[model samples]
Target: MAGWEVRPSDPGRARRRRMLGLLLVLCLPLAFYAGGLWQQYKAPAAVVGALPVTVQDEQLLAEVEELRQRLLVLSSAEKVSQQANEQSRLTIKLLEEQIYKQQQDLASYKGVLAPASRREGLRIRTFELQATDRPDYFRYKILLSRVGKGDTPLEGQLQVAIVGKQGDQDVTHELSALTVDVPEAAPTQSLAFAFKHFQAIPEADRFAELKVPEGFIPREIRVRAEVQGEKPLVRTFKWNKEE
Candidate 1:
């Protein structure tokens, strides 16, 4: 008897198995590539979470913070400037009010001292003499007493003169343009005047005439005080020459 021959599997079934095997092989490589991409993407998150920040990144953050602080300082400065301006305005207003009050007080004093009799009893006193260098100028200070039998201070020009002998001729210097106002029934107040190069040089033998201008000088240094009208209260002084 001949050996029994086994029938081979179906051609379609064999082909299907071969195709399945090929598909499996191709899918394996694709899966491996996809896994590598996933790992590559996930590595950044893991590393960043675990690693410390770099010095450059920290410096950038610090710079940003510094800029923010500068902006804050600038804003604060602006506010301060605005506040200072407001304060200045208030200060100016206060000063203006004070000036107005002083002016009113001055006016009232003048009204009281406007009489001729008040001028006749005016009290005058010399106070100080300041001599300065370079320009050879002198400043004379005098006090005028405002306390008198009046409601206002006296208002008049104070005539001042300095006379000395230079060589042969007599030298005279006069300052008759100084006008003063004294408050009536008040304490003594000061007045000042400045003279430039008012001196006599006997050695040079030149009589340095420092006389006040003809029209400006008063022959009789007197107060033209206003009573019902106006009158003159004259006073005279003769200066002695100093060697």
Candidate 2:
């Protein structure tokens, strides 16, 4: 009859095995849920704690701030430039007005001192004839003395004439006329005259021709000066033989 017989399983061992298998099945879903929550809420803390922000990102933020500052500076400069231009225009306008006023004042002052009426101190002192390099032209120089005693300079026009003596008659002609700008209360002044091309009075014959009639010696010349709105000034002077 025979060799082996089958024994019955232990109750505790079987119960323990079933219980372990059931626990594994129930905990698997809970573990999976817990892992998802940790990834959502706590994963960033670990990463942030371990690593620092990148330099590139920091630089980008700095560049944006710098651009903002530059824009503000440019706006301020434009405002300043506009103000300066306005001030410059105003200053130029004021200067022009002042210059015009000064000119008007000068003109008025000149008029008050030299009114056209009294011709007291005007006189001619000397007469001179000289030659220039130009042919057929002579320069006449006249020295005058302002006889006016006023403090202001006198302004007047001098009328001159050249007289020639024929055998028995006197021929008078106008040589050259000039305006004398005598200063106020000045003692002596000079006047010059340039005769148009005249072959009769060339450089070689610098002397002016004077003809004395039968009774005259051609000794002296007469001069008269007239100021606007004033009487004329008259005088006579002898011509120097050596001149």
Candidate 3:
């Protein structure tokens, strides 16, 4: 039989191979752990830098809110100031109207009392038509003044007529015919007047409110004073509406 040749194994080489395999396994775990730590570190740097921007944004929002509140307050103040100015204007207008009325009254009284302004016979001092709240109604005022004639009171029958257009036709209406209902003490057919110096139409009431017929446009007013034992005094005035 032929003798077989024996091959010898190297223990050092086997040991070195085993040690290299163990090192590779350990290094894989260490590399994974280091990569996770690096990602965490890089992300935090960017996050930390953004903190200043967030603080600035909060400060800007606060400033905007403060400005909005200031604007609102200013707007409220301006509105109040406008209202006050409007009220002041209205007050001034009312005062001016009062002053004008007082001046007119003073002039009227002076005309009646002054000797140089005296007239001998019955005089139609003033005749005015004022608009009432109703569109088809009016308030009228007539003042009669007398001077130097007599201590005896003058008596008269006052007749008033209005000439106007009624639907393309000329129409005339007597004051008594258009007169509204009145108390028994008041005159019905015609206004009666008896006064020493001055007399106002509708002696009891300051003015009389007359209803104008529909479709009638007034143009002129005629007044006749039929005084006892004296010639009648007739006066005509163009119709003009006062305020």
Report the number of clashing residue pairs per model: 5, 10, 0
Ten residues in a row with the worst lDDT in model 2?
193-202
Question: Residue-wise lDDT of candidate 2 within 106-165, one digit each (tens)?
Answer: 443443344457454544444554333443344454444443345545556666665556
Global lDDT of each model?
0.45, 0.52, 0.77
Candidates sorted by lDDT, descending order? 3, 2, 1
lDDT of 1 by residue, 1-243 (tens): 489888886899989999999999999999999999999999999889756667668889999999999999999999999999989976865665455445434543553355755543444322223322323333333333432354443455444554444556555444332222223532232223221211111112111122333333222322122222335333443322111
Cα-based TM-score, every candidate: 0.29, 0.36, 0.52
lDDT of 2: 0.52
| Model with the higher lDDT, candidate 1 or 2 | 2
Candidate 1 ranges beyond 4 A from true positions: 1-59, 78-104, 107-116, 119-243
Residue 205, model 2: Cα distance from true site in angstroms: 57
- TM-score of the candidate numbered 3? 0.52
Best by lDDT: 3
TM-score of 1: 0.29
How do the residues 37-100 of candidate 3 rate in per-residue lDDT, one tens digit apiece? 9999999999999999999999999999999999999999999999999899768656654554
**Descending-TM-score candidate ranking:** 3, 2, 1
The CA lDDT at 45 in model 1 is 96
